[model samples]
Target chain A: MLTAAPERSSHTIALVGLPNSGKSTVFNALTGFRQRTANYPGVTIAPFVGWVHRDGHSVAFVDLPGIYSLSPKSEDEHLAVRFLRGELPDAPTPDRLLVIVDGTQLERGLVLLSWVAPLHLPTALVITMIDELKARGGVLDVEELERRLGIPVFTVVGRRGIGIEEIRRSALAWEPWGIPFLPLPPDASVEERYQWARELSAAVLHFPRPDTRSERIDQVALHPVWGLILFAMVMMLFFQAIFTLAQPGMEALEAGIGWLQQMVENTLPEGILRNFLSHGILGGVGAVVVFLPQIALLYFLLTLLEDSGYFARAAFVVDRFLGSFGLQGRAFFPLLGGFACAIPAILSTRVIPSWQERLTTMLIIPLMTCSARLPVYTLLITATIPPVSVGGVISAQALVMMGLYLLGAGTGLIIAWLLRHTLLRGAKAPFILELPPYRLPAWRTVLGRTWSSTWAFIHTAGTIILALSIVLWALTEIPPVSVPPGTPPLEAQRLQLENSLAGQIGHLLQPLFAPLGFDWKITVAILGSFAAREVFISFLGQLYAIDVEAAEGTLRHVLAQTLPIPVALSLLTFYVYALQCISTMAVLRRESGSWRWVALALGYTFALAYCLSFLVYQAARWLLG
Target chain B: MGQTEIEVPLNRAPLRRQLVVRRYEGESSVIERLCELGLTIGTQLLIRRRAPLGGGIEVEFRGVRVGLRLREAAVLYVTACGDSNAYRSS
Candidate 1:
């Protein structure tokens, strides 16, 4: 749904620029509309589409993937080239073009412009980072550039919102804008086009000094040993912030959900409506929503790192190690994002240029212990493991949690190695990444992206999760059984559940899962968790007739009493390896563009889950005996 | 004089030295990408810094900095031209 095509507008402008040319900054500054992710039919990583409205005029602008030239090489660049030429099906051909150029790199920008000149589209030049240029003793004569290229030129500082409104006003008036005049022949060679760009740039742009500050920073930031140390420090800080900084926010959200549940209970009468409202709706969604703090922080920190230009250096630092494993440095971000949520992490693998490497990266992302699995892991560890300190340093429960994370990450690496050698093996693609100059992160962009990603999470909770919760409620509540009027509430609920559709399905699957030490009730909750990992806790709460909001303490107590240590450990092992998230599978299908790969991924993960869980259960049983 | 202009792969080129692109011998896709990034023949480039642990080398040309893996860099043949300081604006 996020990548649906944009609504057609009367007039559309396509924004084209090289990567790190501040193209997204300009798009974010000008467009007030909610951005829609645009996925062209054969494109793996889609462009962004948004609308700019002013003075009763609205123009849809598609932000094409950053490309250095129109000559198609990569899949996304081919899509960009085709989209500009009106060749892509199911996507509207743009009416005009906004050619964005980095103020500091006019010559390189002109090379790209040279390719676009032949398209004969109504093109206007947008010069970003003008401030960075001037600070470095560079001169860009916008009027001279306009005269030289026969294109309207405007300079804007996207970070500070400088001249944004003027660009918005003129973006809709492309009819009178100057189209680039190509002096060279239509069949000019690459060398000739570059020569033309060089002459044109020399005439209009001048840089008297190099970016000494960036070079100085890179001395340490890109240093072999120090650079790696710094990279590790940054990663440590990132994960540390996610856990420490998000705690208070998570607690507040939990308390808010608890209060809302209380309000609903006081207002609604005792019956199906009350039970559904408090336990079904609130319980199911609240469990997922509590992780909102971690999700928001993850995107916030990632955006900051990307905008500040440190991510590229980190990738550079790790390229050798990751390359040894048949994955490139760009895969690092998606794998790290997997820790927050595999849905977004899988989406992020688009940065990798190679199809084989990208597929390998995507296949391993679900094994990285996403935040959705955190609640399930915590519950099991708290229930099965003792709280005694390990060597008087860390609690055994904490140690178990850390061990599970390491296991997930370790297993993901091993599988990546295997996939690279077997199913997805291919020659490595060229790793040529531009390292943009570091600058202060734009707060507006950071906060906006955080809100959008967080909003996406809420949307998921409201739709897919809500629908699944309703289905779970219906499956457990239907075919209600009669009980004595004086019977206990918990017993009555259990009786009704045993007769419901879910109970029947669970009974059917229980024998299959018996090797893993799971009972019928656990089978039911495990099945419900396929919608999302966090739903397991709510399902267990529902089956036990406990309010999920306040069930954390009681649920742990109840689980410890009802479940043996072996079963709990086995279940934890299952979650560590199972591909349980439907949303993740959906994203994997869309990204890989093949349901066959999805089936393969599902098969492999399920096999791993079953085999490891069976082994753990049997070993535990033998040890206890 | 022609013999004096020895060509070396960019990955083996000395750090902070200005070099001219002689030719690229690699996969067509890789060569095309390099040209599109303005590494066409005769364009002057400087090896700004080499990443630690053989990660890659940072190459600067046309005032744009790009990180290229050693494998990709090894495909680009370059001839040492002038001092890096003299080609500051390349």
Candidate 2:
């Protein structure tokens, strides 16, 4: 029975490989649920570390980002090479290295192996994708390869867990192959190394012919005309799935949280503890939790796309368009993921090789109108825009919602272009992408990856949101004072909120927001929403609960009756551009690895939101009034 | 049979045309990368297609497809092996 050992006794082993080589799958098989998938390429970007126990001792395994060679061209490759050379500060030097090779592309894999060979580290080889190779009528002489390289070679179908135990044993024993370092000749060029790898592969690999299915698929998938169409269709279905499929699950989660809040409110005595648990902890965390379905769906689809080898094609298709904005084609997935949530999207930018491109993508991701803003947008659209249809087809409300989404995306692209010419000016990184052969995505791999990502989000962001929610709750309920006799409960609650710290801060900021057509109540909601965009809706819900006449009315109904159209439109525009989520700022700090960038991002976005909202409000008043 | 091999830029190579890499005329980094990706002299390459709207070119070599920018593709000098029926059949 395998069990996790004490961390102090765990030996570290690093799994290295070329891109698309099934290294991550092998790591998943060895570590089980103990692993977390960071889903990015750099060593520091998403260090996926897992531990496996063997005979009372545990071995820590790190799945490093895939690279083609030791020579670093991109940031990810640089980090990977540095980590392998034990030059990365604060990272534990792996006691051993397990190099995974793609059996189907043995020659290419051998080139990378040769580079690792000169390092003379304690290393072994696990040849993967053997099933795909066998399907193409190929056979690899694993024993012969082991003899030629003087290393232990294990053949594996990582997706199905074949030969996982043997690899585990090899890691546990910490056996170095002791293969003599095959040093590169002085002044040897990449061609010479390629020749060497070719000779090595010729010695052990036998295949009747190249696999034709992948070629056939690529003909359609990479065709300039049809590929773009296919990509668009695939993306359309992907977004539709996220919106439609996740709807029921999101609703269920929301209802479940609401029920829990009500239960605690009813069962617990009415006190600070009850208030904190029901409103602060439950409400704040629930806002983040309801988004789990969308996040999970996004990861699941992305994993499938990645596993099937279509993502590279998609990147290739979009390279030209993204290049104009000073972003690499690889930034497409992260930006698309941004539509679901910016946190995972920022983490996903590790796939971009250039530091500038990755940073630019991170800066613009929050502008992608994440699902968090949906509730706010929906509420505003419902309250302000009529349900009248144009030509009996498009609803005015739906059009406004779509326009807001486009506004967010358009502003992001324009900013990307501006940043590229000014702050991020440099020669564009040369585009060199390898189109991996298409394969059927394994179900277990996709599910395991999605589960790990969902767990990571809940574990990391959930705690911060919960803590902030509690702090906000305290701010809303301070300076213990009772309502005066004969005062209406609604007015008393309003006065209590107005007198609280959160309310006072809102009042202090009212003058600043006055230009944008927001009153103190709206100002308070905006401040509260800094914890998360969705919090704006919940905060409004709480505020409306104070008005006895409007207490029984829905928050949307109350807002519809109260706020003028210009103010409502202004607020909608504000949410479109504001960096109103603390979790996003926290994620930015972590991903960019600096507070300066976070502060700059926060400062600029707030300014942009305020200026834009003020302009929209003033223009609307001039045009309509 | 050195009949003054007719060389053309890789980007100019017609789709599905088989050619042999003569030399890379690009920057050192591009040359190094091309060599690392097994596009060294004497390697066979088939131009798959030009990306839509002049984005890049897709070249097939060694059972793999590599997408290269048009400028990078222009640096590769290839000698067209006129109508290699045997290569196509294979």
Candidate 3:
């Protein structure tokens, strides 16, 4: 071991272990709210770092991604190994290592210990899940294990904070001295190492027969036929809960934002400031913020699924289907979450072990028809498709909506397959998922995770959305034109909007969209809606509301009367395929850690939308004419 | 003893049959990974269940449950410990 002077004021210790070893739970207990979780294997990934106050000094704990061995076969494991060697750029070499070993599966953990122990760092072992071990009538001789390994081994029930303080104190006082090396052949094969681990485990660990509860549960959870049925049912309920539970909170937020906008309108004098405040700032930002409850609910349910150890089984159940698409089984949850929103879905892709699979999943998640598209779909369907009942039960409009959703999902899967073969061609990573024992999710951990993700969403992507909203507002507000006398108020407003910068840009882009049967006004709405897809409805509302006195009906009626069937159909198809949401772009950039991906996603989606919409419009005109 | 031992890919093993890993038939790195998961030569594993649609197999080893894709499981060579009659019964 290399000796170096230790920094007194603060120290960094990396928490390393196998996946499902409760390392994160221990980190959360030590660091409280000072931690941040992120994708650890991606291009822009970073280890989760949290600070804890111990004694008089502040200690920062870096929670590296879990891996079974230092010799990594997957990208996540590679990252963990790199971080331990202090080779990661901008990451400090940890002064000490806190290796977490699962007490119930000591032999598996000992293999990892044999790998890490040779590094000769100031290391300590924290044996977690001891409660599970004891519940199965097992006992571990920690003192004897400590003697064998020459490291302080603390038995901790991390979930319940048992023996945590003693571990914390020992970790804080860790020094690179008196650590004995295990006696092994200098050139030990992995099999030889495993043999040594087994012998050591036998010396210090004693247990009754293995508990059969998890195995019994696995019989049902892993059944070839019933498992898939159970998985589908569970996922269906999960997505349903995301939509149903978050609806009230979403509506309440909308009302709250609407109230705030009204107060601003009533209080402020009518001017550009009022318009910018209500429409630009509040409206633009509130549009994204209203989806927070849904994002939170999606993450909350996902955390529960992951914590309960069912996620691994779900992955196992879906691996074959996912493998055919060059995706991993873990992509199932993230793709399912994409139906609610793509931002959190992208964030949750961290669970996927392969970087290639994760990126492929990220690129395709936006195509899952997020909730943000509902408003635009509803507006177009309400205007174009009448409420004729099919079989006296289902409405034709509802069927059309369902058809659009199916189209989006179908396109997403096809594109994922295509990308896998083209841009992301590589050998499929090996799948070895650990099915942790079933346990009720720690509510505190779930809530904490949900809160952090929500906050991170608002803090990082929220600002970008706010800025784009302001920019869009300015685009429509600038180059004010004078209205002639005797022009009605609504007509004057329309004239001003037509002469504005946004309108001019719309005219410039009109020729491109003209093939899709879109007018300049529709083009302007499309441009403004780039802030978010749902903004398309409000933009159309504002544009159509201009001819209020001259129009004989509601805005919907006016839109229906003015737009031909071909044009309306083209517009709906465009919105269905278009990557128009700035927040999603921002989140994608953040998650992938590459502006290149963001540009590629935007370019391809726009290209697809334009080509498909043009084809639809031409076909409709040809058929109807 | 070696000639009499019946070896098969782990993925082909019957459910509920106990097997002892003899060797891995893939890349050395793959073998190393299996060893890290306590599936080294001489380690005992019980075949739990195959996943739906031939996705993977669930196995119990070292008091933990592990899921492996069919391709990875196929690389693991193991010998059934009990009589052939017992394996056929399951």
TM-score of chain A of each: 0.92, 0.94, 0.92
The per-prediction tally of clashing pairs is 2, 0, 0
Q: Candidate 3 local accuracy as lDDT?
A: 0.80
TM-score per model (chain B): 0.85, 0.83, 0.80
Best candidate per TM-score, number? Answer: 2
Write down the worst ten-residue block by lDDT for model 2 chain A. A37-46
TM-score of chain B of 3: 0.80
lDDT of 3 by residue, A371-425 (tens): 9888778778898877899999999999889888888878888888988899888
lDDT of 2 at A91: 79
Stretches of candidate 2 off by over 4 Å are: A1-9, A37-44, A173-176, A180-187, A485-491, A548-551, B1-4, B82-90
A453: Cα error in model 3, Å: 2.3
Model 1 residue runs over 4 Å out of place are: A1-9, A38-46, A72-79, A173-175, A456-462, A544-553, B1-4, B83-85
**Most lDDT-accurate candidate:** 1
Task: Give lDDT tens digits, candidate 1, residues A303-375.
Answer: 8999999998888888887888889888998899898888778877777878899899999999999888888
For residues B44-89, write the lDDT of model 1, one tens digit per residue.
8989888787868999886778899988998899998755565644
Q: Please give the distance, in angstroms, between residue A526's alpha carbon in candidate 3 and its true position after superposition.
A: 1.4
